[model samples]
Target: MGHRFELHKDVELAATPEQVWEAIATGPGIDSWFMGRSEIEPGEGGRTRLTMAGHVEEATITAWEPGKRFADRTEPGPDGTFTAMEYLIEGRDQGGAVLRLVQSGVLGDNWETEYEAMKVGWDMYLGTLAAYLAHFPGRTAAPVSAFRPGAGGPDAVWAAVTRAFGLAGPVAEGQSVRLAVDGLPPIEGVVDLAGLPTYVGVRTADGLYRFLYSGAERGDALVLGHHLFADDQDPARAERAWQEWVTALPIG
Candidate 1:
């Protein structure tokens, strides 16, 4: 990767180094907190791919050290794009672990906006990773994201969302919630995560619902990724329910 741009995030988690490594290195573990579906071919130069709602991103494994580090280097893009990603695991001085991600690459002209978005995305996903380890360790995640694009500004969208999902206030970890929407089935789960202002996740007996916010000039949108039970509870139906429900929302 060229030394044009770089984005890095370091997180201290309450899990061990082995646990952190497993969460980042394994396919199913990544599914728990990342894109809807992911598969990793272990070892240096192995290929890893992620698919969520038909969108795909792939990269070649660049570094591999069990319980210590894992990295990837993506192919060059048509627009002179370059990427080198790394996940480093270290034991914390306290009784926990620290997981760090360093992503560096060369960018075209519109790099600033993209870089900021990447930062937020990394913070959100890594926060989810920490939450998954804390709440649902040793479990594989099956995820499906229901997209609702062009929903408008965050304030209006968030209000509609709270009213629709029976969320009375800002989301936080470990809060109990009850679903109150149609088209989709009933959801009852503790707030597995609530990285509010953008990310909120609910882990239920059937699966997980990870809500994501997209803030852009074109129009902000929302995506709800139902993980670990996309098939368990009628995949098509759940997505349809969400699409229908979101369509019904008052778009601002």
Candidate 2:
């Protein structure tokens, strides 16, 4: 065998072991967090394929214990390297569970280099999965900084903003709507806030908007603030324009 490399990671999920297991066992559930299409057969000798962005990795289940433990031996890659991946779900006294991922196998000459990169990538991806699972059914969208009465009602506010900064174009049914602003590049998306079912075009790159809508406030108000933007833009101008745009909207 060639030189071997092992990688292990653990994440404490705020979900029951069953919930975690469900997430791991089901295709949709696994896709939601693992960034792939995973097919997991439920018993020993089962196999799996984790496909992400068109890349696929094959694994064979060597062990399975329902909602508790799952292990697999991955097929070696072209470089003659492979991994034995395993997961252990331990129920905690507090009604949650701790999920640990362990990977051990053979590696080529640069094990340390690859290991370091894997460490960082796993930390970020697993952290994201944990957070997303914790906030299941929640939408992640643009942040909201302030909302105040405008000259017109919410409808008017919507119109003015849309008129000033029209939709980048019609988005696909399930895709996000991009907004076009003058002198600034288009923003990625607008999300529905609270009971507001329709997507609201809110700029979130400038940092002018610090707070996000959590479905709490009411009234036809012009919601505005620093939206997120590219660093190349003048921060002060972006903030000022964002504030001014909110004020210019018509309130009821």
Candidate 3:
């Protein structure tokens, strides 16, 4: 038999199979959790292009059962090997579901060592996936953060934040909005102002922050403020509070 390597791990999620499948199915969804900007043609004989950090790989989908299973095969690394990966989702007796990832393939020399390294990588990645789904179920867009020490005062800060966050795409001045960041809960808020003399506050998904904003300053300094639930909350909660606060600020 050819030298083969396998790695498998299972995680119990607080989401339904359909919810988990959505995260892995859609292109942006896949990017948010696994790779970046995935081009997945669902169903048999379809193909998926996953951009890992900066590297890109092409894979073919061998099977696709909505809310249940997704399998793909891809050419190996630079050495021209090959790899097969599958994601299996099944409902549990209690509720929620279990997600299992099975990766198998032949190997070159040092196969055992390579397998161990990959095991760690997948463990971290899957943990990220789980955390993402648990917080923001069906959302998949990264938050934007920018800072401008001194440009045009409040007007400059407004432009900096808008440009950095990419909020120039037909957004109404006084409308409510929500955005999702990978591994973080969604942000809910409204655009308080469009130019100088502006103020905005966003209520986060986890209710950690009641408000976050940048003020119109007289000089080269702008003050940013973020309201948190409390200091004694979980570290994750506190971090999210600060992140949402920072992400909402304008960048220079």
Candidate 4:
């Protein structure tokens, strides 16, 4: 049986509606904040695609209104499962803009688990968006992604990750972190977002490093969705290095 669900979230950004529109409606813009590599075709009926780790998903644009609103819907699968997402942007008189997201979908047997995971995932992505607009507005970022399979539940996996980073306990926002991984130079940054087992984001001088727990069931227990704004960084190489780093972690 298929079950339907919808989620609503609103985020206020310290950016103009046009700026917010650019981030949501363009490929590079989306790449700066959201997961995976994304491509958007113009106008209503055009297509939107996201590619990650050799997996590709595409959706058709259902509504497009430039800086005002954008919406898309995925084709139904054989089990009658489909997903739709809508973003509404409204400028505030005092400045900035409010971006509202409405995501609705139909799921197969594991609806409850999938719904919970999606909820957590969206929260992390939206938080990243706000951070991007605040700290790296108008800058294009090269996206870096990596993932690792994991066992155990959320708490256990999260604990292992914290231990690998030498964190004593839960990650705290504003706390300092220094990374000296193999193949990469020393990285010094401060935590900007920390949401327990689900996500943690760090902001350095030129990057936003986001770590996500895509759920134990999904097999991608640890995911790195990073945005590097520095011109010297190569995304593909960074991704490979991070993948190696994640795989080598003592999380098992």
Candidate 5:
């Protein structure tokens, strides 16, 4: 049986509606905060494509109202399961803007785990969005991503990640962290999101780094989603360094 679900989140950003709209509706805007690389065709009925680790998924834009609203839906699968996402942006009288997100979808079998993970995932991504607007406004990031396969479930993966990064117990927002992966340049930053068993985010002066635990049910273990804002950073080199570092982790 398929399970239907809807998740809603509202966040106030320190940016204008135009800025918020650009972040949510444009390709470069999404690449800076969300998972993978994205390309969006303008206006309603157009296509939105996201590519990650050589895999691609596309959705059709269902609604498009510049600076106000944008929505997209993926085609239903064989079991009639599909995902739809909508973003509503409203400019606030005091200056910034309020961004609301509604994500509705139907999930096949393992719905509970998937739904729970999705909930956490959105919260993390939205936080990244907020960070992007507040600190790195008007800049497009060079995205960096890598996956650690065959890592055990969430608990084991979280343990290993924290252990590697020297994080003890549950990390809190505002906590300072230093990442010293052997193959990559050292990263020193502050923790921005820390939802145990699901996500950990670190924000450095030049980047937003995300560590995600994909549940065991999905057959994938951990994912590193990072965005570098420094003009001299090479995304390809950074990605390779991360990939090598993750693949060498003592897991499973």
Candidate 6:
């Protein structure tokens, strides 16, 4: 099939190639930063499964080498096309590692919409990955999201989101921050993801915050998501707190 879309990104990780491999190759490791619950047999041709928010996704390991490289491709999507994904790891001569992601495939008839969404999603997930290594080193995360249509431009919507999260303002990737909302305890983390009025994120001691501006052409929408990294409890409380805060924001 003629591949119609591709997205590639490279991120510097404050980790070793082995540490990076742990998060990318193993199921439990991926669970720490990527999916809801993941199970992967890392040898070539092994099975890989990821369950997210009750939905399951499967893939086959196309390539694998411990502490080096890994790759997988999903089953054909609705468009009769499959997305081939790859992770290339290189240990820097100075120290640390560089992780690269290349996802390419056909995106069917709704290519533009799907492609854009995937780009944004990757930005959040990958940034979360780096941040996870920095703080919550060995914990897996569960996702919870809350979004609502808004009544204004991206700038205004983003402003409202910042105020709600107690963020001083827009931040740059890698900036350390501490959030102080009125009804909650202090939340602290680093800005692993940042893209102006489009997206921003902070990976905290126990989780991550991914804030977004969406559907502006139709009617703006503000989406706030949490990736909670804990083994004992459901993410319900965090989800409810965020949903209520968004509803009470002055943006819309």
- In terms of TM-score, the best-performing candidate is 4
Error of 6 at 201 (Å): 1.2
* C-alpha lDDT (0 to 100) for residue 169 of candidate 3: 52
Which prediction has the highest lDDT against the true structure?
5
How much lDDT does each candidate structure score? Answer: 0.77, 0.55, 0.58, 0.88, 0.90, 0.76
lDDT of 3 by residue, 70-177 (tens): 999986666656788899999888988999989988776657655765675565446546656765666664422222334445555556555534466543545566
Name the lDDT of candidate 6.
0.76
Backbone clashes in candidate 5 total 0
On the 0 to 100 scale, the lDDT of residue 188 in model 4 is 81
Error of 6 at 221 (Å): 4.7
- Angstrom error of the Cα, residue 106, model 1: value is 2.0
**After best superposition, candidate 1 residue 185: deviation in angstroms?**
4.4
| Candidate 1 accuracy as lDDT | 0.77
Q: Report each candidate's C-alpha RMSD, comma-separated, in the order given.
A: 2.9, 16.9, 15.1, 1.5, 1.7, 3.5
| Candidate with more favorable, higher lDDT: 1 or 6 | 1
TM-score of 1: 0.86
Roughly what TM-score does model 2 have, to 2 decimal places?
A: 0.53
Once superposed on the true structure, which residue ranges of model 1 sit more than 4 Å away at CA? 1-3, 169-175, 181-185, 190-196, 203-206, 229-237
TM per candidate = 0.86, 0.53, 0.54, 0.95, 0.93, 0.78
- Model 1 steric clash total: 2
Q: Which residue runs of candidate 5 sit more than 4 Å off their true CA positions?
A: none
Which residue runs of candidate 4 sit more than 4 Å off their true CA positions?
A: 164-166
- The per-residue C-alpha lDDT of model 1 at residue 187 equals 77
Residue 153 Cα positional deviation in candidate 6, in Å, after optimal superposition: 4.6
